[model samples]
Target: MSRRRQRVGALAAGSVVVCALGAPVAFAAPATTSEITGNGAWVAQAYENTATGIYLTPQQSDVEGPARAPFGSGSHRMVIGESTVQTELYRTPKYDGTPLADITRLEYSTFARRTNGAGALRQPTFLRLNVDKDGDGDQDEQLFFFPANNTDQQAVANGVWQHWVVTGSGLLNVGGDAGAGSATTLAAYKTANPAAELINNDDPADGTATTADGGSIALITGGGNGGGTDSQANGEYFVDRVVVGLDGVDTLFDLGPAAAVQTVATSGATVTPSNLQGWYHEAYDAVDYLDSNQAFVDGPGATPAGGGALRFALSTTTNPDRVELFRTTQFDGTLVRDLRTLKFSTFQRATGANTTPQQPVYLRLSVDTNGDGGMDDTLFYAPANNGTVAQSTWQSWDAASGVWGVNGDQGNGSVTLAEYVVAHPDAVIVKNAYQDRPGGGVAFLVGASGASQMNGEYFLDDVTIGSVDAATGRTSSAKRFDLDSVAPAVSVGDARVLEGNSGTVLNFPVALSRAVPRAVAVDFATVAGTATAGQDFTAASGILTIPAGANSGSITVKVASDKVREPHEALSVKLTARDYGTLGKAVGAGSILNDDTKVALELGKAAKHRVEASVKTKAPVAKATVKLFRVVKGKNVRVLKDELSKKGRLSTVLDEQFEKGTKVKLFAKVRTPHGVYVSETVRHTVR
Candidate 1:
C-alpha cells in the first residue's frame, strides 16, 4: 500500500527523490494479533511518487532478551539519512471494515536517536491507520498518531526505551479536502466525520491496495516536503513489542532477530579475554601484541592473580592521536544510572626513559546524553586525576565510585556520579562515531593528544561491573571478566635419601609455573621399581594441594631402614593434575641408598700365628682398630690391641710365649663419619 505522506508546508526545491519499484515482500497474514516473527522487514514507498533514503536491519549485536524488549530476542532498527521523503513498515490486519469505536488499545515500544547535527528534532515513528470516512468501499482518510504530541520532552530522551499508547489520543487527518493544517483527537475526528469504517483488502501481493483502500496499519518515520523544516530530519529508531487490541483481545507482535542465545548477554555476565570474541580493537602497528590492541600476555608484569592478562598499548609514534579497547558487541544502549560498580586491575609501564609512575590508559565511556547517534560527552575515570598510579605493579580502580571528569561541557574536572545522573538522567553507553573504528559502548582509552606521556603498555584483568534494578534498586552480583591466556603447569622434582636404622623421609618438590587466586590440587601415588611398598618405603597416595597464592609445595614419603646390605632401590611419585591446570614433569624419581657395612677376617699363611682382617662399606671408614684376647681357666683376658691400616686391614703376630692348644679371639671395630661399625668375633688356636 502507499505508506507515505507529505507535510503541511511549502515544498523545498532541489530535493532528492527515491522510488521503490521492486515487488514488496508480503507480511504475515493478519490474525487476532499480528506478529513479526523472524527478522522483521520494512519496504520503501513514496508519498506522491517520492521516497526518502531508508535503511532497515535487525540489530545483530548482543542484546539481552526480554530485558530490553520484554518479548523478543532482538530489536529492529531503522535509520533515516535524508529528510523530505517518507518511508514505513506496514501490515495488513483482519479487522478491516470495523468501526473506529471498536479499537481499544494501540501501542508499541520505541527507541529513538538522532545524529550530531540534527537539532531539537525529537519525534520518533508515528502510527497510521486507514479509515473509510463515508462508509464507502474506498478508504480515503489517513489518521496519524505522533508520540511527541502526547508525551513530555523528558520522556523523549535518547537511548531509552519508551512505550506509547495512541488509541485514545489525538490524531492529525489529511484526507480529501480536509487540510493537514487542522489537528484533532480521535473522538472529535470521528464525530466530525461520522460513519467512519475501516477498509480491508485481502490481497497484499497484487499491489492493488493503495492508501485509499484501507485494510492496513503502518509504523512510519522520516519527514516530507511539507510541515516545517524540523519535520524532515534525520533519525535512528527501533520498534518492538507492537500491541494492537481489537474488541477484547490483544495481540502482541514480537519483532527483531530469532529467539536464540548469543555469545554474551548485555548485562550480568562475565568475559575472560583469552581471545577477541565479543570485543573490538584496532590494529595500528607491526608489533603483534601491542598493535592488535588487545593481546593475551603472561609473566611478572602481567596478571597479578596469575595466569595471563589482557594487554593493550598506545604509542607516541604510531598511534599518537587516540586509542581505545572495548567490548566488540556488548553493552550498547545500557543506562549509566543503572550501573552499581565498575572495577578492573591494571599493570602499567612506559616504553621510554620516563620513570615517573603513571597509568597508560584510563576508563572512558562514550555517552549519548541527548538521544543522538553521536557522542554528546565522554566520562573519564583517570587514575592520575583521582589517586596515585604505580608503575610495573597491578593497581585496581573503583571506577563507579570515583569522581569522573565530564568532557562534554568543556571539562568539568570533578563530576560526581550522583551529579552526572541528575544532569543527564537518560545518558547511556553507545557506539561513538569514529572515522577509523567502531568504538564500543564501554572502553579504555588513551587520549594521546592531551596526555603526552600516554606512550606505554598496559595490562588489564579482573574487569567487573555490577548493575542495580531500576525498579527495585537492589544490586546484582558483579559480572567478572578474568582476562586469562593459559592455565598453570605443575611439575615435581626428583629426590634422594640415605636409608637409616630408623625411619627417614624423602621430600619431593611440587611446583607451579605461576601463582593463582584459587588453590590447585593434584593426585599423586608412589610407584615401586626396586623398592617394595612396605619393606623399603611407606607407600603414599593422596591429593597434593598447593595453597592459593603459593607456587610450591612438597610431598613426603617415609623410608623404612634396616641393617641388611643390599643395592640401592629406586621409586617414583607420579602426579595427575586437575582442571584449570596442566602437568609438566609428571613423575618424580627417588633413590634410597644402602648404609650397611661388611668385614672379613682370616689367618695369614706367610707367618705363624699371624692374623689379618679388613673392613669394607658403602661409606669410607675413617679409622679401624683390632683386638686380640686369650681364654684361660674359662675367663677371657686381653692380650693385644692395635690400630689397623687406612684400608681397614690389620696383620700382627702373637707374642713368643705361646703354647699349643691356646684359645684366642680377634675382632675389628671401624669408624666412619656417619657411624661406627663392628665385625663378628673370630676364634683361633695356635698349632
Candidate 2:
C-alpha cells in the first residue's frame, strides 16, 4: 500500500521574545535595503512509529518531561519507518506560497543534529526543497532533495550538531567538500525503469521526497533494510535554526549573559563542565553555574525568555575571573578587521561575593593579530572610560564611544579599539581574551596562558562586528571623551648636517601619541655640543604645526659650512609639549659630517715607464693609507699602493704597463678617521 504523504502546517513566525538586559533584543535587523526571514529556532516538528520514546530537546536528553515537551530549546523531529517532518520559513518559503519571481538566487542555512537508536544505521535523513512553477497546488515537478549522512557512530542519536548551508543556483551545492552533492535530478528519479531512489552524492537512505497540491514539500526519511527489523530502526533529529533569504541576515550565537544554560542543577551544585550545553567554562574565586531560579542571577532579566541564562560572579570587579567560549582559536580575528564596530549584549549583577556597586560587566577583545598563534593585540573597553553596563540591563556596543576601549595591557601603552579599527582594517586572528596575559606560542585552545589561566567570570551575548555604515545609529560625535579637544603626547624629531657642504637642510620628525581633533603645534630648540651656533649652523626655534587627525609633523634645521676638516659633531633638539597634552620622551640628536678634499693629485710619470699618484693634504698626512686607481671602461680599478712622504705627499707607479695614449683615468685615495676619502677623478692620456 502506498503511504499517503501527510501535510504539517508551518510553525510560528518569530523566536521567543527575549530581553537584551534593560530592553528587548533587537536582533540585527535587516538593513533598510534588505528583508529578513527566520523560523523560530528549535521549533520544527517530529513524527515516528517506533516504540522507543521520542523527545523534544537539543541536549543529549532533557529531564523536563522532554519526551512530551513538544518543542525543545534546540528542537528536532523524531523519525520512524519512512516517516516525514517539515522545515518552515516565515514568508520566504516557496514550499506552499507563490514562488518568488525575483528569485535571482536561493540560499539555505540551518543547524541539525541526528538522533537515532543503536540499531544498524544507513543514511536516514534528507531535505527536499520545492517550487511551484504554476499556480497549481502541487510542486511535484519542481522538487530537489539533499540527502544528509549520519556516518559518525559516536555522535549518532542525539549527537553533536553541525551547521549546513545550501547555495541553490542551477544545482544544489554545499560549497565545500564536507557537504555531498547529487547529480541525480528530480526528473531522473521518476524515469528510472524500476524507479530507483535518487540519492545523489549523499549515501542512499532510501528516503523519498514529494510535494503536495499546495506546493508544500515533505521528507520521507528512509526506513530499515526491510521494515520488520531493528536494522530499519527509527531515526530522530533536532534543528536549532533555519534561515532563508530573499535577502536576509545570518544567525549568530553569542556565548553568555542572555545565553540560557541548559543544565538544571541538583540543589547546591558546584560549577562544572558536565552541566553545560553550548558553553565551555572555568571557575574559581567565584561560582559560575546555570541557576534555574531567577534569584541566582539577581541582576535583571536573569532568565532568558526561554527560562535560563549563564551567570557569572559579578556586576563589576577588577578581576574578570570568569567564563568564555570552548577555546581561544574558536574565533578568527581577521573577520572583523574591516568592521568599524563590534556589538554585543551583556547582563550584570552586584550579587554573591562580588557586591561591588559598579555596573560594568566587561570583556576584552583579543585577536591573534601577530599570527604567532596567540591573541597578543588586546583592546579593552575600559569601564572607567567606557560607561558601566547597568545591572540587569541589555546594552549595545555600537563601536561608538562607550564600546571602543584601550589595549589589553590595561591602556598603559596600547592603541584604542577605535584607533586599531582605523589602522588595522585587514587584521585577522581575533578573539575575546579568554585568559589573562595570554602567553604566546600556543594553539587557540592550548598551552601557556599566564596567571589568567583560571580567573575571571562574566556573562555576554550577541557579538557582531559591523562597518560605520552598517551601524548608522553610531556616530563619530559620540566618542566618550573629547579626544580632539585635548592635546596628546609627542616625540621630538632629529636632524643631521654636513659641515663640509653647509646649506644642507636637516629634517626632524615629531610623532604624536594619538590622533587629536584640533590642529596643534610643538616648540623645538637645538642645544649645541662641540659644534657652535650661528657660526657652524644658525640656532633654530619654532613651532611644528600638526593638523587635526594628524599624528606627526616635520621641522628643518639649516647647516652652514666653512674650510675645516673635523670629526662628526652632534647637536641635541628638545621638543616641549603644547598645553593640550602631557609630554613623553623629548630629545633628538643631529650629526655633522666633516668630509673635506684633503688629497691633491699631481699626476706625473715616475720616469720609469709607469704612472704616479702624488697626494698632498692641507696638513701633514697622518696615519693614512694612500692608494691609486686607473679607470677601466668607466670604472675605477685599483692600480697601486704608496706610503705618503711624512711631509704629507706620495707618488706611486702603475703595476701594469699601458699602451700609448690609452687615455686612463686616475684618482688618489686616502683613509681618514672619518672614513676612506677619495679625490676628484683626473684623466691622463698615457704619456
Candidate 3:
C-alpha cells in the first residue's frame, strides 16, 4: 500500500491502553500528559485509522521482560484495527534534510504477539523515509522497509519484542515512481539516486517544508482497511528506542509518556536532601554505599510516578546499619495527634531462599509521651506487619492508616496511628538527643536484626508526611522527600598564574556535586610535568578538608619564577578521595606563563677585527647559545655561534671581517625538553 497517499490531519482526541506482551487485555485509566510525551522533538499525526490518541504510553515490559527497554520506563504504542490503512506516524525534524549518503544505521524495536490471528504475519510497522530527490522543494520519493518482506528479520514468535535494521542489505525498497524493487542497501540507493535527500513535513505552515510539521522518518503501522490478511491487521504494536544514525552519530528517541519522563539521576550520586526543604540525611554509624548502590533507576513498576526510582541497601549481618534519613526541624515538636499523611513507595524483589519476599524498610517516629526531656516512645510502621507486600514490582503503603507498633504496645493487635494518637494525646516528636538516641524525628530504619533481611538490597522513594487540622479537616502542609542514589562527585578546576620571580600561589578550586552531612577530606599532590616541582614550583601534598554542608574548597601551591625569557610551562595536580566522594575529573592542570620580556644583544669595541656579541634579558642568561649572522646575498649567513663566553657570560666574538656600517643580526637560543626558546631577531651594526 502507498503510505504517502494516506497522509491526513491531526490525530483524533481519545485514548487507547494495552497490557504488556503476555498480560491479559485490561482497560486502564486514560493516560495523562506526563505519560504520553517526553521529548518535544517528536509529534504524532494519524491517517486512515481512527486513533483515540497517538502518544507515548507507560504500559511496557520491564528490563528483564520480553522487550528490550531502551530509553525510558515506557514505549510508543500504535493502535491498529480493521481499517484498511491505519497509520499512527511519529516524526521528528532532527534528521530532516539529511542526505541519504550520510546515513549509516536506522534501527528500532517493536513488541508483537506471536499467535494465530489476522495480523500474525503482519510486521510491526514500515520504516518510511520521505525523500526530496533532485533537491526540489517537494518530496518526490518514499523509501520504506517492511519487516515482513525482509527475510533477514527475526522470525521468532511467542509474544516478544524484536529489532529491525532498515539500512543494511535487503532492507530498503523504493516505492512510487522510483519503481518497486529492493534497493539492497542505503549506499546503493544513494549511488543510483544521487539527488536523494531526506525531506520531512516538519512544518506545514512554513510553506518552505516539503512535508508537514511532522518529521523525516515515519514509524507507520496498520496498512489497508479490511478484515482480510493483507490490508487490515487487528493488533496493537509498541515501538520504542528509535535509533537514527547520521554522519557517524546516532540519536535515540526514548518514546514514553510525557509526565513520567524525567532525567535519570546518576546512579551513585550522594545527594543530601535539602534541609530548607524539610529533608536531610544524618550521619549515623552505618556504611554509606556512596559508590556501591544506585540512587536512580528505570523499569516498569520500578518508580511510582516517573522513570527513576531510588535504590539503597542496608545490612544487619555485622553491626547495626540503616539509612538515617530525617526531616530537619519542621516536625521537631509536632504532636503525633495532628499527623495526617504518612506514606512511601518501595520496590521489593523476589527472594530465592524464602517463600515470602523481603520486606521494605520501616517508618519510625521518635515520640515523647511522658513529658520527659528524652524520647521514651518509639513508634514503627513495618511493611511486613501493616500492608500486603508483593515481589518484583512497585507498591505504596499508607502508614498512617496501617497498624503501628509502639515500644510497649506491641501485641498481636497493633493499634493504628490514629488509635495511638488518641490514647496519648500529649505525644509529640522529641527535638533533643538523649542517651545516644537521636531525639524526636522521623526516619526510615531497617537492618538491626534477622538473617532473612540481612545483606539484602532495597529501593525507597516518594516519602510523604503531612499534618491536618482536625477541626477544619484541612491539610496544613505535606512534605515529600525525593530520595535518590546520587553521591557527591569531587573535581578540581584548572589554574593559571604568571611565573613570578618569587613564590607565587596558584589556587585551584575544588568542588563537589552536592554537600554532605559529614566533612569530606581529599588528598592532593603536585606532579612534575614540563615544570619540575621544588625547582619551578613548590612540591606540596596534604589533605584538604571540605567542611560539612559546604560544596567547595581550594588548594594553594607556591610556584617559583626566574625572570628569563622562556616558554610557558605546565604541571599536574592530582586528587584522591577513596572514603569521602567519587572522583570526577581527578587531575587539575596548572599553567605558569612566562612574563620576563627584556632581551638585548650588545656590540663592544675590539682592537682586532673581532666584534663582540652578548645577549641579556631581565635576568642573567644561562647556558644560552649566541649566534652572529650578517646578511649575504639577501640571506643572513651564520658567522659565529657558541654557548657562552669563557667568563660564563652569553658573549661571543666574531673574527670575520665586516664593513663598518654592515648590519648584522644577533640571535640567542635556549633548548629545553618542552621546546626551544628563541629571542626576537636583534639587529646590530658591525662598526
Which structure among the candidates has the greatest lDDT?
Answer: 1
Candidate with more favorable, higher lDDT: 1 or 3? 1
Q: Kindly give the stretch of ten consecutive residues in candidate 2 with the minimal lDDT sum.
A: 15-24
Worst 10 residues of 1 by lDDT: 11-20
What are the per-residue Cα lDDT tens digits for candidate 2 across 1-687? 212132211111111110000111112222222322223222233322234423222212212212222111233343443332222211112423523332222332222333443445433234455543444443333343343432221232333343333333223322211343444432333243122211212111223433211213333233223343433235444333233333332222111012232322221111122332112343221232212211112223422211122344422243332222222233343333223434444554444554443333334445444346544444434343444445556564544344332232222223344334323322454433324423221011100112212122344434433332112212211111110112367887567756655467667788888765455677888889877887666799987777766888877777777545567777778888654444766988888776664677777665545566578875566757888887788787887776666677775566667676667678878875555667778877666
For each candidate, what is the lDDT?
0.59, 0.41, 0.59
**10 residues in a row with least lDDT, candidate 3:** 12-21
- Give TM per candidate: 0.42, 0.27, 0.31
Clashing pairs for model 1 are: 8-227, 9-227, 97-198, 158-371, 199-214, 279-328
| Residue 327, model 2, lDDT | 23
TM-score of 1: 0.42
Q: Which lDDT value does model 3 have at 679? A: 63
Query: Which portions of model 3 show Cα errors greater than 4 Å?
Result: 1-358, 364-380, 385-600, 608-610, 616-625, 631-634, 645-650, 661-665, 669-674, 683-687
Candidate 3 local lDDT, 1-687, one digit each (tens) = 111222111111111100010112222111111111244677666654333322333222213223434334456766565634555676677778888888875877777542335444555666788888889766787787776666556663425657677776645777721323444567788888887888874434324444464777787765465465643266656776676656644555656554232222222222233312444444233223212233354333425432345555555444334333343455777777567678888775533444434667566777777667456566667776665667666788898788765652243445666455433445787654423333336765544424434455566767777764333222355666655434468899999998766667789999988776456678999988899887888999999888766899999999887857678889988999855456888999999998764556677655454577776544444555555555566686777666744333675667877777767665555433323445666666666
Clash statistics: count for each candidate = 6, 33, 27
Candidate 1 lDDT tens digits, 1-687: 122232111111111111111122222112322222332333333232143232334212323433355333456565555544444444445567778777665777777777546566546767777878887777677777777656532356566777776665544555421433465677676677778866653323324453332235766666454333554356666776666666644555556656443223333222345445466664322112133456666633435444567777666676654344555436667677667678878777877865544454567677777677556666666666556777788888888877665552112245556446544446777776344455576776543323333567777777776665444232344466666667678999999998877868899999999887557789999999899999999999999889767899999999998766679999999999764467999999999988766555554322454433333433444345555555466666666676756665556665543455655565555554445565566776656
lDDT of 1 at 61: 31
What is the descending lDDT order?
1, 3, 2
User: Sorted by TM-score, highest first, which candidate order results?
Assistant: 1, 3, 2
